[model samples]
Target: MIRRWIAVAVALSLVGCGEDPPASPGRFGEVTSAVVLVNPVINQGSTTSVATGGERSGVEFQAEDLTVATDSTGMALVEDLPTGTVTLDFDPGTYSFQVVREKELYDVVLAYRDGTVQPLFPPVRYPLGGEVVEVEPGESIAEAAASDDTIVLLKEGTYPGNLELRAEGVLIFGAWSPTRGPLSVIEGNVTVLGGGNRMRGVKVTGRLTSNANTFSAAFSDIASATITGNGVTLLRNRFTAGQATVPSSNAVLVDNTGIP
Candidate 1:
């Protein structure tokens, strides 16, 4: 409900004025705060530049440093912020997200209530080694995949949006290497329409589906999977919330956690 109102107010501000104010999350309170969610489907660990109003008549203002936390939901929160418009400046790079595999980071803002704000950030993946294309911040994942064959070096950054794998035999490997690389979170649901794809070292917070496609994965974290593809092997991956929803298929699952 609070988020809805905030959205409404932002919208009205946008409508009233020709453009957004220089500083946004505009129109936020003395107690105004925010919750940032990384859409794991699109990010490596994300960092935001934060500014807030001062304690006095909303005239004085100060910048606040944000702290990242990895709770059960792995969300971050800011509290006791002054009621003032806030704007986030995103810097693209790798971050030590404290997860097995690095996930991409996406930032979201909401009304700061009595200190209960939650948002999810996300996007990654894999092979021994292959032809590589290193991605940058706010680039197109699908475009990179479509052009680059064999492997994609998804360096620490946020993709513009979700990804759909159209190339067969392409291995989407997140980060620079296994031992190295920051958080790589995908922001949207993913589907591999082609076959013989491989992945590792990426965190996806949305549903994953493979239709009649065969793929292999390891060290990847998936929210959920619906695999109709045969000859699939999932090894040492993390599945949150539930297990893979598969019908009849030759699927191999080994050392996967969080499946009931």
Candidate 2:
């Protein structure tokens, strides 16, 4: 009887000594939030320049698989960003941004954020001829005639001649006097320079592009023209015609005067 009791006690002790089940592992914590800021400027006029904010004041933020958030102060807060380097994309405009990690702060000037960095300066001005270059009525000139090297100066007179620019280059139509009228008509790829100029009387039978160089025109008439290529900017330029078409190859740069 005594031996049996001792065996039973030993069995109970062994059962108690068995290892307990392992505790479950804890989960990862949530990621912290980040913020960015953007500011843009819109210019309107010729000799006089002004900076004002309109209904078009807004910045777009792009990240991989993440939607960015912005506040009234132009601060963009990025959520759910993993613990690694992140790339942010923005529109074509000037931006002042700051990156903060813990208590450390980083200041940066971002003109563009994507695959490359573009210059922040506006388009370079190409001077028109001191004397206007007049084209006679019913005259036709080829791209070779209007050499890409020269800036054709249109005089303040009726030019019934047709101008053609076949090669890739800039055609600057500037006036010595601010009061001088704009180009009456263009038949090829050209950049009209000067503000408050009118293109209502002008007719474009070929491709036409503006580098946002700030030229004025009252009426614009385009026919089967593709406004494509780099540095093709248009700033407050009006277009009017009986029939006009914008080709898929054509692109317009707004408020961008960068060199091609």
Candidate 3:
């Protein structure tokens, strides 16, 4: 799937955070090269620019999707996040951000004059601008998995046995926390029959199988998994079933354990 990511370029004055103090935390750096959420409240797709420092600063990143994933649901991210590092120069402030694609909280860092980067933790949510579909506890993930161009979030709870995902262009996510609150578990086999299926932040205690469809997962746990198709990408996940050779394709495996 094509990765659609949104980014921001903001001057110091127009940036502010809700539900927290708005003052510039402290002035410590000449340039802060960090990722930030600038003017997240505004819809940037139609608005090309905003006034900053008495000048019209054109919007650098355009939001591709308007539906944003709210809360920690496994809902699809509003935009395709660009991978790798982004550099932003800014003055010291109490800033916070969130990455939509990665579905994780964001941190605002301070850059010192001596080139030291200090990240301010306690991250907050920044909407990627998309429609959010809420999945309550004990809800079936089938509809969310079958949808396209929507964000699906499963509240912290255990789901029923096994899930069959045959849809294309959908993301069903679970709560992502180190504490693992709302610990989510799929008790049965997860079968993917379509292409561009992505899974993250959940534990599949049963077997994971896929046809010759394109699949991707990150930071997930799989018991014993098998694949019959190509275009499978697994990153930073653990598979107890170890590795198996597909008849016709090779998997794009990165930072995954017990998979060859």
Candidate 4:
């Protein structure tokens, strides 16, 4: 009920000046007495074999009775919040978060909706002997994969075109923003024909199709995924399209949120 009023007040603020000034959230208390900064982020390690990640951009949530939104840097400043034990409610459709009090401040941590923090798992690191291939946005991921390198690192940017991996045992790691979502986004479809491949911290805006080669993805986002390989694994992933096809007898899915 409180959030609904806040929404209506916010809507009124956007109207042209002919309307009366909207009521402030400060009606609940002194809006200037206590100002707090909130950082809403997606913390990694909520799923299997995922890394401790970074902050998101442009997120919105509620601080006490007032609705606040974060900027592109994923930080918001809220004034007039009651000093003690303020309750925060996040949008349940997008993420699961919990508020942990420290001194007079609060730390928002991502977890299950039940307030259960899942155990953290160390992310996959680059191998010692394998060649490391680095690619910037607009560069060819396919070319990097063609090098048959052990690791392909995508810097923070968008890559265009489809990606097909035929190399065996390759690991693709992308620059990721935990709370803001994927930093490295692939604009086209991804086809994996290679065996024993792993991908982490990336977002594929297009569909993903994998053949008989075993594949695993952690902490990533895909529009849709189709796996025909045995022993495939998907952990802590978000499928925006809510479509996934995996052989139940051979695939493992854990702690993922999206359309079923």
RMSD of each: 17.6, 30.2, 15.9, 16.5
Candidate topping lDDT:
4
The sequence of per-residue lDDT tens digits that candidate 4 reaches over residues 148-174 is: 435666667788768898888777767
**Per-residue C-alpha lDDT of model 3 across residues 1-260, encoded as one tens digit per residue:** 11122222111212331211111111101122222323221111112132212111221222232322222211111233333333333322222233343323222312122323233222222222333454555667776556554445554566765788776755555555544421556777888777766666667878888774657665577787776666565544667666433323354443356653
**Candidate 4, which segments miss by more than 4 Å at Cα?**
1-126
Ranking by TM-score: 4, 3, 1, 2
Task: Tell me model 1's lDDT, rounded to 2 decimals.
Answer: 0.45
TM-score of each: 0.46, 0.33, 0.50, 0.52
Q: Residue 38 in model 4: shift from native, Å?
A: 25
Q: Could you tell me the C-alpha RMSD of candidate 2 in Å?
A: 30.2
| CA lDDT for candidate 2 | 0.31
- Measured by TM-score, the strongest candidate is 4
Please give, for residues 105-168, the per-residue lDDT of candidate 2 as tens digits: 1211123333243322232222221221223333432322343333232322333333433423
- lDDT score of residue 1 within candidate 3: 13
Candidate 3 residue spans exceeding 4 A from truth: 1-85, 88-131, 179-182, 241-250
Q: After superposition, how far is residue 68 of candidate 1 from its true place, in Å?
A: 34
Q: Each model's C-alpha lDDT?
A: 0.45, 0.31, 0.43, 0.54
Which ranges of candidate 2 are over 4 A from the true structure? 1-121, 127-145, 174-183, 186-225, 242-252, 255-260
